[model samples]
Target: MKNRTAVIDLGTNTFNLIIAEKNEGALNELVHLEEGVKLGEGGINKGNIQEAAFLRGMQMMKHFSGLLKKYEVSNYKAIATSAIRNAKNGPDFIKQVKVQTGIVIESINGQKEAEYIYGGVKSSGALSDKTSLILDIGGGSVECILCNHSELFWKESFEIGAARLMDIFHKEDPIPSEKITELNRYLEEKLEPLFEQCKIFKPHNLIGSAGAFDTFVEMIETEKGNDVDLRELKTYLFDSIAFAEITDWLCTSSHEQRINRKSIIPLRVDMIVTASILTGFIIEKLGVKEIGMSAYSMKEGILSKLIR
Candidate 1:
């Protein structure tokens, strides 16, 4: 049998597993699984993991562990991001997972998370020699990595992610302007200190590394034209007008409406509003003309490390 590796990424919103093996010098997937855990649903401000959230996470872990055993994938690594990093009872949750699922989840820091994200982008064979800025907005945090000419330069992680922001400001359905204002204030507070430090990076090229970013790119491209090929290539280049239009449409859309209109599932619909705002702000602040998308992330990072 061919050797295989499994990488599990436990995020605040979902637990994802990528099982693959090297073939012809490339990673080929054998199985991929994603379970919506929403581990950070209500676990941030109070700095605690709620019982319901904990159970959801545990159930997902149990399901993943079963998949691993059934697939007989012995080589594996599991890492938890923002959710675990923030919760006061995070350790307890990790311990419980290990005991219940036989999977030890590593609560990785932002720097390591950035490294994995970089690996994922690099492996995709699309990164060029430009000031590429990679933004990964997860359930509990946002990670920013800057690279010049495919060389790593600087990186930062903010405690601002889709789910976290949703819990923070988008509490009401069809969020109001006042809430948006409050959200911006919160983001500004966190971003202000990083401005001076971010100056050195000089990143003009924009690349977003997450489902939210990818989804936005797809949405804009589809709306502009029914051309799938054209959409895939240039979806990242969301202009100011297009960004505003999409944001306005999504804000007024009920979760069900967004889900049905574009096949956006219920799990993701909740974060659509916050994600749009975040993506728009990132593009505006960086003055980026285009934003790139990559399917690679922490899961790719874990596998790369294991292979090395």
Candidate 2:
């Protein structure tokens, strides 16, 4: 049997698993699964993992562990991000998971997270000779990396992720206008360094990493009545106007309305509004002319390291 490896991404809003194996110098994924555990539901900004949220995370862990055993993974690695890394009880929760499941999860720092996001975006075949600013919108943090196919210029991670934004500003279902303005201003202040780097690099192409971007791709395909399986491509360059329209629709949608969309993932329905605002802020502020989506993200980045 091929040496199958499983990589787990333990995020604030979701837990994703991918099982893959190397074959003749190429990496082939065998299975992929995502669970909406909402590990930060009640306590992201509060700096603690609530009992309910902790239970949800633990349940997902057991589910993933079961799958790992069934697949008989030859190797496995789990990386924990924002929620687990930032929570006051994060270490305790990690210890429990290790004792119960025998799986050790490493909580990565912001700088290292940004590097992994860059690696995944690079493998997605999104960057051209022209530089690209890559954004990975996570539940508890957003990672920004400025790079091209051949060089890396700048990168940073911000704690202003969608879950945190939703916790802070999403009081109204559709999100009030003033809240949107406030969120933009807050982003401007927190992400001034990213703005400065964009000015220096002058990268017009904005490549968004998978997660929220995957939802964007599905929504676009649904709007056009296209049946294309987006998973087939590592990268897709979106039509800027279509993307802008979708962003507006998402921002104006109420919770009930967003939940009804066939294309929007249930886990993302509540945060996509915040996520759209964040994406729109960057596009407008940086004069971004091109928008692209990479099908791969940090999980693939970790897998790349293993196979290499």
Candidate number achieving the greatest TM-score relative to the actual structure: 2
Candidate 2, 225-278: lDDT as tens digits: 976565687899899999999999999999999898989989999898999999
- Per-residue error for 5 in candidate 1, Å, reads 0.1
Lowest-sum lDDT 10-residue window in model 1? 227-236
What is the Cα-based TM-score of model 2? 0.97
Q: What's the CA error at residue 176 for candidate 1, in Å?
A: 0.9
Q: Residue by residue across 180-280, what tens digits does model 1's lDDT show?
A: 88877777788764555457766766777756765666577677665444212422445657767877788777766787756354668889789878877
C-alpha RMSD (angstroms) for model 2: 1.2
C-alpha TM-scores of all predictions? 0.90, 0.97
